[model samples]
Target: MISNEMAQRINTQINREMYSAYFYLGLSAQAETMNLKGVAAWFLAKHGEELAHALKMYRYLIDQDARVQLSEVAAPASVDGGVLPMFERTLEHERGVTATINEMVDFALSAKDHATNIFLQWFVTEQIEEEATVKDIIGRVRLFGDQGQSLLMIDNELAALAKQIGQGAATAA
Candidate 1:
């Protein structure tokens, strides 16, 4: 069983994960507005992944026999800043997630909650990969996002990426 404090923190994280989904959804809309179909699809995939992330935590809480209460998710900030800024925002958001996970790890260790700590280790590794992936995307955006033809090429690449993701999912099933 999980402590009330731990339960509350997990609930908060779930809500934040919901917000992350919305953030990516909003970015998808922004990408669509910019006529970047590939980018929009990429963000939509990210949105779905965030939903899965929240669900993972929700299931963990339920498995722990803890109450799962959801709070309101605040609106994501405006995405009017464009695609490059969206990636920048994504990196920043990921950095914050990494910190929160670190805190949870510390808390788990302090409380001797080995199960929670084990569960959270997945997030620790996930965050590192997340941050690195976003950084790579940001670097690519910086390199190609400024040039029209180049940006279009990048968009095409992203479209292929989305297709590959779909294929991978299909094969896994």
Candidate 2:
């Protein structure tokens, strides 16, 4: 059984993950409004991934015989600018998530929760990839800067990337 303190921390992480899903969904909406279909699809895929992340934590908590209490998710801000700004926000968000995961890892280590630590290893590695992916997208978008054809190519690239990441996650599971 997980300790109450650990369980509470995990629950908070779960809530944050859910909020991430909402945030990405909002970004998807903004992309759609901007007529960036590929970017919209990418954010929609990210929204699904974030939901899966939250569910993973929720299920893990239940499996460990802990209570999973969900809190209300805050509203996500709409991105009014271009793709670069959207991706910049995404990178910032991922960095924040990495920090949160690191905190959880620290807690698990301090408490000698070996199982939680093991489970969190995946997230640590995932954050590395997440940060890299956003940075790559930002770089690509910058390279394309206001070029419709280049943006299309980037969109296609992102679509493939989304599929690849989704497949990798599923295969790992």
Candidate 3:
């Protein structure tokens, strides 16, 4: 069973995850306006992933018989500049998420909540993958230059990746 404090913290994380989904949705809309369909699709896929993360936490809280207090999710600011900037923002957001997850892990450990700690290990690993993936994408954008045929090629690759991610999410679901 989770302590009230831990449950509250997890509830906070659920809200943050919900906000991340909104953030990605906003980015996807921005990508669509820029005519980067593949980028938009990628962002949409990420939005789905964020929702899944929230649901996972929700289920965990239920399993632990803790109250899941959900608060309002703030709207994300409009993303602009360009695709690279958008991804930079994504990386920044993801890093923030990683920090929060780390904090939760530390909290769980210090509280001797081994079950919660074990539960959070999944998020710890997920954050590592998320940050690395964003970094790699940023590197690719930098290496390819974000324009013309090169951008199209990159966009195409993103589209393929989105499809793969979508399939994985579907399978997981």
Q: Which candidate is the best by TM-score?
A: 3
User: How close is every model to the real structure, measured as TM-score?
Assistant: 0.92, 0.94, 0.99
RMSD in Å for candidate 1, one decimal? 1.8
User: Tens-digit lDDT track for model 1 on 5-63?
Assistant: 88888898999899998998998888898999998888887787778779989999999
Q: Global lDDT of each model?
A: 0.85, 0.87, 0.95
Could you give candidate 2's per-residue lDDT for residues 27-46 as a string of tens digits? Answer: 98898887777788888888
Q: List the candidate 1 regions with Cα displacement exceeding 4 Å.
A: 164-173
Ranking by TM-score: 3, 2, 1
* lDDT of prediction 3: 0.95
Error of 1 at 116 (Å): 0.5
Q: Which ranking of candidates, highest lDDT first?
A: 3, 2, 1
**Candidate 3 per-residue C-alpha lDDT over 18-73 given as tens digits, one digit per residue, 9 for 90 to 100:** 99999999999998998999999999999999999999999999999999899999
Cα error, residue 85 of model 1, in Å, equals 1.0
Candidate 2 — what's its lDDT?
Answer: 0.87
Better of 1 and 3 by lDDT: 3
